[model samples]
Target: MFTNTDSLLPRDDVVKFFEDAKTLLELRQDNNVEFWQNMDATALEIWLREDHPDKADTLNSRICLSALRELLSRHLAKMRCAAEWVHRIFEVSISELKSHPDYFILFSELCDDHPELLRDAYIHYGLAQAVQTLMARWYLQPKAEPLAGAKRALPHTFVKASDNEALARLLSRRWTSGDRFYADRDLLRPVVGDACTERKVLIFTRLKESENDSLSLAFDRARTVIEQGPRTSRLTETFADGLLRLPLTSSAGYLEHVRSRVAVLYLFDDRALFVEYPWNRSGTGHQRLAHAYSIGDKALPVQGTDYPVEQYDEVDTLFGWQQVYVPELPEWAAKALAGPSVHVPTSVRANS
Candidate 1:
């Protein structure tokens, strides 16, 4: 239940223009340059304080004056301080401000004072719309329709909305890469066959003496994956490629113990394996030494694609490690592997 716009007093002409916004949707819309250029002192202050709190505050709390009393006491608690005042001036923590209308008023004042920060302030508020939607759904409140897609809402207009668009692009790209970052049901189910069965996958915690104990604890939470399909592969960091590279013999012992007992020792909290080419080595030797490379005899070395590691911790904690034995050679590699089971005989010296 919010007004689109609030009428300003005669002196505050800047606010009068905005008061034209009669609904929350109108208020939520981006403000443009023409709107600012037409502002009188009153309207200017309102925009400055909300849009640029620091600059407005510097010129005597003209913009945020109305809401300052309620927020000043809560300021420290509301928004944490940055190292430099200038940094705070540019970046408004819209989430903290949006919850309290008084804070929003102050934000409006800040925006009025420092027009340059307008783009940033709008973007902050725009992103907060997503968060607000979540909150509304959780609280069973009606969702607010965002004033999206008007010509005035251009990139040059409001900093906050501009920031929102930037974030949208960033997230879109990250989502595209998400599959490589974590374990997916589709991936494991096809290779290991349903993750639920006991023999197919076992989750073992590194912080334990007994694999049996780890499995017991995991079973309580892992009923779906285990019963329906792919088994959870959990192992100590020691069993993982990068961790194994750490110079510690004790690590190898721990890894061997886990590997010998379980079909796949889950590399707990470890990122997926990838390839690493040695700068000095050329041809097969260099290509063979990737993070995802196979060790010992596969009867023959197999080629595979390397997956990029993003925020490994996020994926690892959400979905435990997946252990798949040497991947079925990809189509291209399989065709090549079929031709040769033995190494080419070559007796040339190093200098030759």
Candidate 2:
């Protein structure tokens, strides 16, 4: 069973992941918000990173709304004109041609127009992201620690156009480029960076995105907070989708990604809490609203939308985590393991 080995463990990363999850369960039992907040960081630094002492200067947000309206309107006109021009060439009309009129209509229409428009849409969405980002960043004073700015600042969403994979990946190429956290000069696990970033996507919506399925599911699952136990079944749907959407270039790469940024289902009775187990950050998804949820407690005093459905009992099961012991060994030879062989030892079997 111990075919593969890493310096950290006797078997391999696959086994090590579950062991770390078990540790998180224990931590959850013992502590409160502190444990989750500072999974790796020290107490003091987590404060600086999460709970900022100084608020940014008051934003002139009334202008931001007007600005967003003007900006979106301008872009919409551009897209509509482009759509009209292209469709007219083929003796067609974008408005006349019917779409399913579902959530992805925006994306679907963009795809029908031209591949270039898809590119523009992706850039267009990113530019819209930039608009909100710049507004927030404009007021932020330089941080004493530059990384703190990134770590402490609120999360932003990415837009997608599935046509150009190169362009799609370009946006995130440099994000996790470095591993070390500068605060108090701490070492960072580059693998954990993906987990950290994904966890911050608090404003999940079930808008039926044509972009990344994981983001859609993340928001979809987030809605479970509204009906705590009833949405338990969606876990299976989410897992199935994860399998379908895995960017599996190779078995080895997929396994490594799973091991490093492990998503664990902490079963605390009927309610299961999932940690860092959402969609690929680089996929096509409409990243809407920089601040989608109204600020509130675990009870979630949301004004209208039912996102951030309060706190959830994330622990997934009444019993400990289990594995069915994959019947076959991973073809990667050097990389699979079973805890203890079910059959008798070769010598014992022969003796029997």
Candidate 3:
């Protein structure tokens, strides 16, 4: 596998990032609740002044402003949108803005003043705007709704905008701008020659019901189905629309198991036959099923609905045939490993 190297940022810049992150992490650990609940800009400034004296003047100057911005923006994303860790992310942006406040101001204004503008915007705009507004308000306003106050604090929006433009005049940072190349079926199409098998077997496994043992069974059945080739057999149909529900966290675990199995399986034959199952279940399917199950009678989908009774039969559909790989380890076994009795390798494998 090719290792992705850092583009062109200086070693010093990267080193500073890790050092700052370490200090920030330590600060967070010490004042857990205060870190989230309250903004103590002055205290942060004082700490920066004393501890990171070399970077103090600059760090202290921006601490409160950045913290405030991060706090509010994260709160906004959480309250307004059920976004994940909206605050922590915004804090990072605020830090970036410390060196370039002007750009941050304009960016914040755009995101806050026009929430809908970044609907189609990529990660950069969304992340930038989310952070900028909060930081600008924290530094510039001493009262509530600081961004709103800043709107009037300046002689005009244009003047504030000019101040932002002036900040842009300072040190310019170079970032690599380009499109990301994701690995997909299309990318592999060329490498897969014409001699490849036209058939594709997509296993639909449910993580919820599958014990590690059950997963072994499922994989065995999947392989048998694959060996049978892509016929319009009952197994084929079952593999297509079968729904599997598991605990949300277990989904990643199941996928990792599947990926590792496939990686080992591929070593046997390099033939252009795609056999892995599709994990991308339709959100609509889940919603519809949830609605059906929530009904007063708890009846399964009947004649009227698109899902026929025969189609939804799980047992008749799954567990028909199979192989034995990593038999599902017992939950008790997992628990035992947590203690000293059992030993699991310390090396952690990243999920595919």
For this target, which candidate reaches the highest lDDT against the unseen true structure?
3
Model 3 clash tally, residue pairs: 12
- Per-residue lDDT of candidate 3, residues 1-352 (tens digit): 1125654332443345334543543333211122333323343334334445566444444543354434434433332231222333344444454324344345446556556535523433345543444444333334333343222111000011122221121102221121111122222223222211212212222112323322222231221111112221121112312322221221222322221122111100111112333222221222332433332133532334443333323334322323212234234322321322222112212122
Model 2 TM-score (2 dp): 0.19
Candidate 3, superposed: residue stretches over 4 Å from native = 1-289, 295-338, 341-343, 346-351
Give one digit per residue, the lDDT tens place, for model 2 in 1-352: 1223454233232233224333433332111122222132222122222322241111123443233334334443443344333334223433343222221224445456556545655544443332223222222224243343232211212323132232222222232211111111011111112223211211111122233432322221221122123332111112322221111111122222221122332111111122344332111110111121212122333445443232234534212211111112112211111122222111101100
Rank by TM-score (best first):
3, 2, 1
TM-scores for all predictions:
0.17, 0.19, 0.22
List residue ranges in candidate 1 displaced over 4 A.
1-87, 90-107, 119-352
lDDT (tens digit, per residue) of candidate 1 on 1-352: 1234554322243233234322211232122212212222343334334444455434363553544322222221111111111223323443343233232234346457656445543433332233233233222334454345311110100011122332122222212121111221222222222221111222122222243322222221110011011222121222221221111121232222121121232222221111111111111212223222232223222223232222334232323333433222134322322332232212111110
Point to the candidate with the largest TM-score.
3
User: What is the alpha-carbon lDDT of model 1 when measured against the actual structure?
Assistant: 0.26
lDDT on C-alpha atoms for all candidate structures: 0.26, 0.26, 0.29
TM-score for candidate 1, please give it.
Answer: 0.17
Model 3, residue 308: displacement in angstroms?
Answer: 6.0
